[model samples]
Target: MLLYGSTDSGHSYKIRAFLLLTASPHAYQWIDLALPQSHRLAAFVAASKFGEVPVLLDQGQAMCQSNAILMYLAQRVGKLAGAETEWQGVLEWLSWESNRIGFSLPNLRYALRWSAQPPEVLHYLRQRVLADLARLDAAVSAQDFLLPSGPSIADLSCSAYLFWLDQVGIDESAYPHLQRWLARLRALPHWQHPDLAMQAVAPDTSLARDE
Candidate 1:
């Protein structure tokens, strides 16, 4: 299996973290987003339907989108898939993460770290992130993971970006339960920081193609 991604992307980290935690065998190819699309690996550009990172090539198939890739990995490994009874709930949480924390957190992080946004835009993102964090804290307050069955892809999906909360100046203290949940995830065997989990591979100029 081959996974294509960028190190700084939380979306990409989601798949990398899962692969690491499950001890799954896969080769990771780092696509330097700083380069123009024309200079990216031809195979990656062809495989990525949306022209984005976190594209997984396996069994002669290319899987795009982070949440979809998570679901595929869970099903393939038969681990971290949640209980069959809770499958619907797992899907719901994944959807929620995509729409909620997934939307607010990454954008906020990007605006703060990579590029500057207008003050009003920054305020809106901060507010959305706070609300999403509160919702997550409340959800996990009574349980150790998102689903009662224990850690699933939903937990992995939602928690990936939160690891870099400090980058966006979000105070972790405000969400104790969320913090604890993150700590629990860290305790998982084979867990590594996102940066370490998805290291960059030297770009293969041979694979470069025109856009």
Candidate 2:
């Protein structure tokens, strides 16, 4: 198996963490997006139609999208997202995360780190982020994970971008339940910080550049 991904990508980190947590055998190649050479790679470009990172090349097949890869790998291992009883709930949260957190917080993070924008634009994104976090807070407040069964790919998908909340000027104190849930995830075995997990694969010079 080969993974073509960027070191700073949360989407890439989700797949990397799953593979590592499961002790899956694979080789990872870091893509330096900063280099023009990266975009010109014929094989990678062919594998990823959208020119995105975290493309998992398994058995001569290319799997795109982080959530899809997470679900595929989890189901293959009979863990993470394997419980039939909670499968629908897991899928629901996965869809929700893609539609909700995947857009808002990561957008905010990107804006905060890499883009210059008007105060109004930042404010608008922050509002969206707060609303999404509130939804997650309400869901996980009285439970251990999103589905009430346990942590699944849903939790991994949702929490990926959140590992950088403080870095993006989002106050964790504002959402206590969300913070608690994050803490629980941090305490889990084989839980590596996103940057740390990325580094474990292979260092890319791009890691030093904030985005």
What lDDT does each candidate get?
0.90, 0.81
Which candidate wins on lDDT?
Answer: 1
RMSD of 1: 3.7
- Tell me which residue pairs clash in candidate 2: none
Candidate 2 per-residue lDDT, tens place, 1-211, comes to 6777776799998888787767776776677766675555576788886788888877667889998998888887777884678888888888888888888888788888888789998898889898998998888888988877687788899999888888778787789999999998888888889887776445344432211
lDDT of 1 by residue, 1-211 (tens): 7789997899999998888889987777898889899999898999999999989888888999999999999999998999999999989999999999999999999999889999999999999999999999999999999999899999999998998998988778889999999999999999999878767866445433221
TM-score of 2: 0.89
Worst 10 residues of 2 by lDDT: 202-211
Candidate 1 residue pairs that clash: none
RMSD of each: 3.7, 5.1
Clashes of each: 0, 0
